[model samples]
Target: MFKISRRKSVNLSIAVALSFIAVVAVIAVLIPFAWENTPYFSKLVNDVVINESQQLGRCVFFVWLYICFAIVEACCVMVFVLLIRVRKGLVFSEISVDCLRYISWLCMLLSLFLFVGEIFHPLMFVMAMAVVFLGLCLRVTKNVIELATSIKQEHDFTI
Candidate 1:
């Protein structure tokens, strides 16, 4: 019977955690670039040119805040994966496949929205990279689901 070894399970968990962290990092870097270059933000700045320093400070603060937020998010995802691995067996499961698919789709949709917003914000390249990353994640999830289902069916037949 085809089975997922413990080592493979640990590796897959690590891979997913790494991917999640990478995605969050991309988003953290992209948002600030988009905000600073956006025409609406610029117009807002022009309206209060006298408070330029404050505005700049606020932007910097927000970027830092988001960086922290991304780190927390990544940590949460990693911890959750680790907990699952430690508690349950490491074999591929429907829940894991669904989580992967959901995250990929949501991130892709979010990236698309951000990219379109970049028309006025002017961070097209960053958003484009995010889109590509999300696309690859979606592909990964699709393959994972297929592989899991195939193996499950084979196991069932043998039993």
Candidate 2:
């Protein structure tokens, strides 16, 4: 395999990554609103029951925590994308690759938490979402690898 330059790979990864950030950000903002406004989601949220007020608070806290985590993960991706867009000459391919993997793992963990923590089966729904997010991350990783290899080959030919 031809060696690929980190810069080109990173640039492509960042471009693709920005879309992920936008999607995650939209979800992060919209989910709460949807839960509040949409009749179906509102019903689900309102229907959840816990033994005590403290437990109810805990449920809300957990939901908030999950959303916060998603926001943070998306922000990390966005920050890297911003860096890639502004900088030149050098590449941060490894960082981009790692971020995709880490974010996917985070989604998996959050899904597991929801699956186990929530009394209702709504956690299953969250888990399904996590699967989709993870799949997107995998696609990104594949694209990055392909871009890296292509860049490396191009640079080698130019040498």
Leading candidate by TM-score? 1
> Over the stretch 1-159, how does candidate 2's per-residue lDDT look in tens digits?
976677777776777667677776787667656654667654444555653464464467547556656645664664565456336533435555554556556556655555554554456666657665765776576477658856876887899
Reference-based TM-score, model 1: 0.46
Each candidate: RMSD: 8.6, 8.0
Question: Could you tell me which 10 consecutive residues in candidate 2 have the lowest summed lDDT?
Answer: 85-94
Model 1: per-residue lDDT, tens digit, 1-159? 788977677677777767777777787677668866776655544444334575674564465446445534644474466436545764366656655555565565556555544433357559657666966866686687769767987998899
Best by lDDT: 1
Clashing residue pairs for model 1: none
List TM-score per model, in order: 0.46, 0.45
Superposed model 1: Cα runs more than 4 Å off: 1-87
Clashing pairs in 2: 3-152, 4-152
Q: Over 4 Å off in model 2, which ranges?
A: 1-13, 51-101, 122-159
True lDDT of residue 52, candidate 2 = 45
Report clashes for each candidate as comma-separated counts. Answer: 0, 2
